[model samples]
Target chain A: MTGSKTTEYVTLVSNDGYEFKLLRSAACLAGTIKKALDPTSGFIETTQNRVDLPTINGVVLEKVCEYLYYNQKHAESRDVSDMDIPPELCLELLIAADYLDV
Target chain B: MSGRRPRGAGIRGPHSALTDFLAANNISAQEIRDSYQQRVRQAEQEAAQTDDNGEGPSNGGAEVEEDLQAESSTMAAERTRKRKRDQDEAIAKIKKGKAAKKVQKKKQKKNSSDDDSDFEDVMDMYKKAKPLPGQLENCELCNKRFTVTPYSKAGPEGGLLCTPCGKEMVKDTKAEAKANKPVVRRGRRKMESNRLDGMTDCGPKTLQQLCIEKLAQHSEDIDELGEMPEGIMNRISEIFSKKRAMNSTTMKLFLQPDMDRVAIHEAAYLETEDYDQIFAICPNVKRLSLRNCCQFKDSNIDYMNEKARALEEIQLLGANLVSNDKWAELFIARGKDLKAFKVEWLDAAFDDEAVEALTTFCPNLERLKLERCKQIGPDSIDAIARLQHLKHLTLRFHDPITREKLTHLIRSIGTNLETLCLEHFLDNTSDPTDDVLATIHTTCTRLSKFRFTENNECTDAGYVNLFSHWSNPPLRYIDINSTRDLDNTNPDGPQESPIGLASAGFLALMTHSGPSLEFLDISSCRHISHETFTLVFDGVKQYPHLVEINLSFCPVVDTHVVAGIFRSCPLVKKVVTFGCFRVEDVRVPQGIVLIGAPRAQDLIEQFGEGSLDL
Candidate 1:
């Protein structure tokens, strides 16, 4: 909203109305973040000086935050090689990451 | 000097100690990389080696790399999480911290650049070792690391060993086998005391007395004599007495039913007169050895046809009655029911048709000997090829069969042909080529015993090509004699085809053939030298499958080479070097039969009895 462009970050709201805040770089790993960021609410408020972002709920939003946090940590350290991650969890994480694109 | 950080309560996740424990237990690099304690073992090993060597800061560079790799993962998540929390705080603090957040975006960009370098290094290492983690474990016994190697034999314990260790285990079992050699415990042949000269005396003679009296032996006891019940005996006596009173006593004696062995032979004598009587006499005779039964005519063979329902075995030695086609049909008919019928001296005009009928009718026939049968040509061989059920066939001294035709006959039959005895085929004057050798080698892949003696034409190339295709090679017994054609450097004038020398041919055979071969016999081939024997024995050692070798009459220089064969091929079951003078140094294995300086007649006799099973 300012003349100087600001980097976008995401806020995910859980079904139970809990909110989680994440960096746009890390939150971009999830497709659900993009959908939430699409701004479907009716007001579409214009911030003359600052962009007023929509608030996300907490419970499901906490899970999305944990997943993005782990993925980012796994990528940076490349230490997932030693992860004796159970096969079921590994498969579930892979599919979830793909659905979220993280 | 007070401590600022917490000591033992830093982290709950697995640390360097776990990796050090895994290394002590012999888990491999791949397993370590897959386990929870990757950095711990590498760090520990580096630390231990540096301490042991008394080297300081020299190991510092690699440790930095390790620490960077670890800290980067935690930092990446820490930055993103911090950034999100800062953004949430910024939403509220925008009015207050508009002046304080001037350098925040620049700091965030610097953090991302650090994460990029760390991710690239880990990815590079992953690419270098395209390791499929958790697929293999370190072998405990070898103390060496390898991936999965399939094991054939079940181990004493449950799991499998690597290839080299498996080979060692198999060698151990072979060593145990070598320790126990089979001892020959032959009982003396059963002596016959009841003479065949119609001697029916009722004397209770001792075994020593019987031997001195030159009496044949009886297998059964006196209690087993053919006896009827007393009531039946009384009835027969009354009938005889009544007939005698009516002057019919001679008629009753003439009507006697029992015919002894002598009477059977006598009935066989008059082929036209007592044809039915001969079959009626000995209907179910088990063991019949007609030694030089010269009077056995074609009509006497009718006894076989009539008693075909019960006759078990028949042997005809030097039986000259089976000369031509007149009795071929009758012999063929008898062959249908006979389990075994061995006809020695089968040198007759018995051509293709007779051989065809014999082979067709005798599907269950076990052993056949057609020795000195010169009249049997390629046509007879063609017929024999169709008899897929024959286990043993000896066609020795058949002068008409050449190698080319013999190979053709073999190819037509294929693997169903088990053992073949084609001797003296090389005595023919035709020149043997590589094609003839290849044909023989290719077709006789399934042949177990191959006896090629006195065939001067088979060259070194033939032996090589024949042996090179020995992946599933079936030769168990082989005999190569008088192979002097290989020595090109002849002392007697100039050699004709100095190319005809047997050295090259023998060497070719030794190089490839000794590996899969179980038994070999090379006697009376004086040109066979020390190099040939050494090559074969050395080949045997490398391959480890050869079990038996015979180098008879090989005029080699040193006897130690023969001894070396025994030392090298420990699995060898037999070593028969009969006529070879230099076998003196050879320490033969326990059960191995070593026949030195044996005569040609004895050699022939041993070969005739067939190969010894190791």
Candidate 2:
């Protein structure tokens, strides 16, 4: 928790005990994650490069992480296709998107 | 003859099947044709004797119609699985057997190419013919009885097909669709739409903005925006509001109940009962803002009065359902603690009595904005004079108030007011009287923003008097638009008084507030001459604080004046020149936007992509 060096990848722990290790650039696409990892604010997440999103479960968090990477990859591109999302998981993903402010 | 192979007498070779048949029956091609012609002639004579309107065409259309029926019924099915090649071949054969109705549809389409209703009707019937789940139906191609399911596919003909045949058809169509992916042409209209809601930077949007937009696109699937920050929630709600997707279901996402502020930017989709949920859930809410709340009735007001006791500020727009009495009651209940209240777009209620009640009860109220309240008249302005602690006052009534009452109101509440906005006074006469202007000048020394617009009454002398170093330091925002003389005959406006913000008044304004003015709108102040515009915005002088200036409808403004303005205001981001026709061309710098110009609209210089200089 007190580590000073910023890692290239961060671990996101979902509530159902699933941890996702992803690129820092992709993870920062989410406003919530970005603010948490903002070094100037000096939250524990900034030093450790890990955040426990307690409310979001494993399935939705996985999708959220996938979306973060997708958004980062297509940041400067045009004619990007829509991401394929399962209809059943749409509502939960939407809630997560709003919460993370993706 | 023997070389031509007509000599069966020369060689006892095997004869063709037709020759053998002809020899066996002793029938020639000529004899067969004569017999067919005789039969056709006999039949024609019989048809001529029995003429009727039943037969529209004698082109064997009835047989083709049956073949059509076979193809269409298959189109009407739910595609489930794919069948094999031989089954597809059999299904194709069945298509020809009962294709009766489809051919007739084709004939109708050919007859009247413009109208599609006839074809659509048959398609509609075919669509409805798909067998319901748990029903027994025979397959169109095989005529084999099978239990119908929701996934049952329509055969190639006209009825629901069994699983194998249906699946084959679905696969074929899927492949067909995959092969023929059409290119979508993205024209300028698409780019303009992207500029709306979405963005168009010098290049693509930033990563964060893209993610935010994607979230907004799939907002309906959102269950709740759980535990998000207030600013982000507000932003999400803003996007949702713009999309008009903020219905009862989506509205709950914005209610961070524990937080003091709850604002719904678009509440037009929310119903009467939806308003109740806010009170029930967000009991601790202090500042409640809802715009276009059309269904906000007396019941919701009562609910808020009872439950939202912590409420100090409430801004509601288009909540006309609350009667005038209810408004007074609300003020009576919550007015002591209320600091700011803005209620607008009232069609019938919130009259003079409501304003009187607000003044009488809400002593602690510091900000009050009432706009487009049709029932409120001059008496409401008179009532507002009684309030002592108001720091900001904005009023746009449906009826016009006299200049005398406005002056009295200003004199009474002007000292405490930091911002005073009065709109649509629209008086006809050119009284050259500066009563209200004089009152504002004398009393409102602390005012930073003064917006009094849509008037033809205040003359140039009044504006000059207001600004000529009498009292108030410098206004940061000033919008005195459409205050010119009304008479088209005397556009010069009485030579002595100079009605509206003419050359002298514009110069007076610049002399007073130019350094501190961040926003200034002297639009429709046509009396200001070309020389005055040039003098006011000369290239030498710099207006450091001017960020946006609207010179719309100022006829005297030309390219020279516009260029002068650009040179003068260094930090100006937007310059609106709507009706200034003489401004045909101007070089807009990067980051600065020139809107409604003849030659340069939204002209932002492309960076890192300009044509190479020779």
Candidate 3:
């Protein structure tokens, strides 16, 4: 956080108090985060530089964070057939995506 | 990079991120799995223990064990019988449920009929007590809560709706009502081929048909063909012509000796003698329009000239048998009294000499239209320009004339011209210049209608200049379709690159004279962009009088611009979009006629067969 060489990151806390530090660009992929962190909106999340998702648990939040990073990496690439999602977390991941409007 | 785990590693190894995350959070997946398995095994063991207790009594004492076993066996049999009775009762319950559903449906039907009668009674009450503003109600369509305002309108089914849903309901009901209208059949009469001789072999003839046949059979009893309405007379003549029943005797029904106006649309079967008989009967005919009069020969024309001397207007189409000299003689005989004369599709007759004779003899001619006349040249136009009383002139030339001759004609007939329509169908290289437009703008101050189609030489500068400061009264109709500027020098460029009227000229026309325009056709003027279209028709300046518009072949017009036109022009009743391929999803207002929009079939189909004239 001190030097320009270090990457800037934002902490997203889940309902069970699990914190996942993600890059700002990847976190902005979620529509909820984009609206909360909008500069003109003057939201508490924008001033505090942290967001708390009360509805999502730690396990589902972890999967959502990983998907956001994966989507950011393959945003423009057309060939993304190698990206795999576990069958067990499919239902939970869908619920989280709907909550975040991702 | 260090914080990021490799892809698919979270599902594989002991040190997977998911496992680490679960471990750090004090929640283990193995614990949950083992607990679930243990719960399932406990439930299974409890079920097995119950089965063993039911089957075995050896753990009790020997004497009591035998008696207990007997009692248990009898009790088990009784329980089995009870289970069978419960199964039967459940089946009866299901059948009863189905019958109850049928009874409920019958009751609902009765209630609906009662509601219909109640609704009629409520209509009188609703008329007395209309809903007031500021009342909260649930929208009938979406069930959303809304407060009724003064602007809220009632839905079609007597339900209340929010503002947005109310508008949609109105649109849907209008579309449904329009789609339900019975279509009127037109074109090419439907003749009954089987009942030609009024002898129906299978069924009895209709009362009307029987009456008509009896009247025709007893022709001697009918002494006079009594006075009938003109429309019915036309229908009777058309029926007679279609049935091949119009012989010399039936023709006498139409040819009354005292008739002043007569029009025969289908006279192809009328021979030369029949036409001579028409002239012999109707001597004082003032207005006569004959279509498909192929048997009208020189002798018939001579007879018409001698008998119908009071004729003021005559319209003849497909009268090609009358020779050019005979037409000239006819004009020379009665052209002075003729105020309006129209002839079309004369293949070999009515040439430049006849035009000279028309201009020379018909000094009081006010309306003259000669369409598809190939032999008329620049000299004929020069002769036509000399008529002082010519108010309406329409010339569709099959041969090209020089631009100088057109300019000379416009300049000569400047002040008195009210309606001028000039269409060129030849592949002529000569284009009308800006000077000709300027001459028209300055001279034709009284012009109310002007149509100049297929002149691919007029430029944007000329149109812009003509509309910039118009001194004439607002034109009621203006059609300049296909008047593009095709740059011959750079033919390989884009097709719409050099258009005659661009966005600037169109904007100028709208700002200056759009208020009074009732009919405007700018089809194939491809240089106007959607931005300019939206800007001009953005509900800022309303075109209250515009009724019909044709925007065909304009590539830039899309659905948004069409919606803007609907918003601005309140009186627009007819919109023709033939080749505007981008314009889809149009919302046609109620009572407005839309034509040739292929992609807007959802909206257009609401208007039944008679609504489209394509």
Candidate 4:
């Protein structure tokens, strides 16, 4: 951590008080996250380098964070069948994905 | 670190917080299983109790005796009676519960039916309820956010729109609807007027009453009539004939000088002097068509031969009074400039000598139509076929010309032929054979419009060979209706046994020349199947100019093939499927006119009239 350098990590706080730290490039895979954390926007989330999603819960947020990193890693490749999801959390994950527009 | 598992290893594990909460609340799968087992045990115990009651006093006698030894016999008897009363009360309570459940079910059904009727009313109320004036909605037309009011109108496509855009849309639709309204004709207007008169009398109008009113009105207007348009003039002439009102004055309005063409169908009232007066007035008339010319005598043609010397085309129907020598003289005088000649329903005065004179003199003739001429024979056709410059010829012969003569006729003048319509009279036995088709295919390379009907000798092989590879440009109009093989030699065989223009021949034609075909009438071609139609038109994309198709009597044309036609030919405007019974419940696309099918008609009526591009 140099004093004058900008940070690359973005903090996403869920509604149920779970915070996920992700790289800015990985977090920008989601369109809503990218908009909220845009540096040129005058939103408080942009200034604080953090986004608070009041609609998504902790479990869905964790899954979404995992998907963001996974998507970024395999963005150049065609296959993404390695990503696994539990059946019980599928409905909630879909709702979160819709809200995030990913 | 023992609690930490590998990534993605907890896919089926207790991953979600909802699952965790459910587990903590003792709502696990095992708990549900235990509750289901408990319910089964209770049901089984009730069934056993019912069985014991069914066995009655015989099974309970041993137990009752055992109880009597411990107590007095009368006390035991009273206890047994009390137990029996309790069992009857329990059974009655179960029956009452079942009846209550049935009533509740019936009430639910009734409530649903009521909701079905009230649903439309509720929707109406919702539509009538307007939002507050300050509420904002996006304009459906411009997509711009604007403040909505109670008076805001709906857009053409059914969404709330701003006031200015709404007004513009309404004006546009009003103009369009006005433009699409049909122009009423004079005949219909007269009928409507007669209907209104009947309505004023407060009674239903019979056909006789309407005709009487029409005639009474016509007589009052005949005296004061002024100059009218040509269409109205023709309509007046037709009405005069129908009402038996044609006289010298009405006949004189038809003789206009410098008229280039004249078609007079009501020439029965005209005497030979009137004919001479018409010939003198309109000498420059190049085309003259006369029907019901019973009063036209042989001398009238001699008079016309000298007066109307510029006549290039003549159509005479029922003009038997004109002698053959007069017709020959007229052809001899004006045949150099004659281009079209048609004679129909002539019993006499149009015989083999007149036909020979016509062929000998009319070297520049382009069109000739001879129908129902009983005296003309194969020799006259052979003479008529000598004109090499003929481009359009329609021959509907009452006398059966031999196949050899027909073949020779086609081969002689088919080089420059553009439209050839050959229809045999139903009474004629001789049919043009496949050799005639072969001759046409080989010689008539410039043909564009062809119609061959009522010919039973042509077959699918001839059609296949003719359309396999044509040397001319793609044909724009083709009508080969009812040219089937009528000799059903095998009466017990299938109906669709291959006939003229079967699936193979039709597909060959479509694949070879379908791009430029604009109007095709393949009605009554019964041998074409649904599968072949789909296969030929499924993904073929060349028919961009096709506008009208008539598959009226084709039995195998189902809905799927119709849909395929709609999909493949994007510019198709009219489809006639009159007797195709398999085509039901068709959803005709917008802007395409569908003529038959009751369900398709209902759909078109429900969604306004379609626009025909032709």
Top lDDT hit = 2
Which lDDT tens digits does candidate 1 get at residues B1-614?
A: 01112337676544487556744543434432433354666667777887888987465758675675667556544655675567555653553233233333444456556766556544544442221222343454664555554443334553445567778889999988868857434221211111111112222222122221221111111122123333332333333233222111211221223422111211112333243444555565543444344556666665556563455455665556655654475556666555555555555455667767777777665555566655666777777667665655666655556666677666665455456665666535466665545665666555676666765566555665666655436466667665445445663212333222255556666555555566676766665557766765552355355676666656672456655665566566555565565444333334333444333332321111212222
- For model 3 the TM-score comes to 0.51
| TM-score of chain A for the candidates in order shown | 0.48, 0.95, 0.87, 0.90
Q: How far is candidate 4 from the true structure (C-alpha RMSD, Å)?
A: 32.6
Pairs in steric clash, model 4: none
10 residues in a row with least lDDT, candidate 2 chain B: B605-614
lDDT of 3 by residue, B26-106 (tens): 454654564456555655665577577885434533454456456655654565567556755576556545655565566
* Per-residue error (Å), model 1, residue B37: 99
Task: Sort candidate 1 into its docking category.
Answer: incorrect
* lDDT of every predicted structure (CA atoms): 0.49, 0.78, 0.71, 0.70
Task: Judge candidate 3 at residue B228 and give its lDDT.
Answer: 52
RMSD for each of the candidates: 36.6, 21.8, 30.9, 32.6
**Residue B508, model 1, lDDT:** 60
- Flag regions of model 2 displaced more than 4 Å: A1-102, B1-200, B426-432, B599-614
lDDT of 4 by residue, B380-493 (tens): 889978988899999888887777888788988999999888885332455445777788888888888888777666677788888887786788888887766665685222
Second chain alone, TM-score for each candidate: 0.46, 0.67, 0.59, 0.58
Best by TM-score: 2
Q: Backbone collision count in every prediction?
A: 25, 27, 0, 0
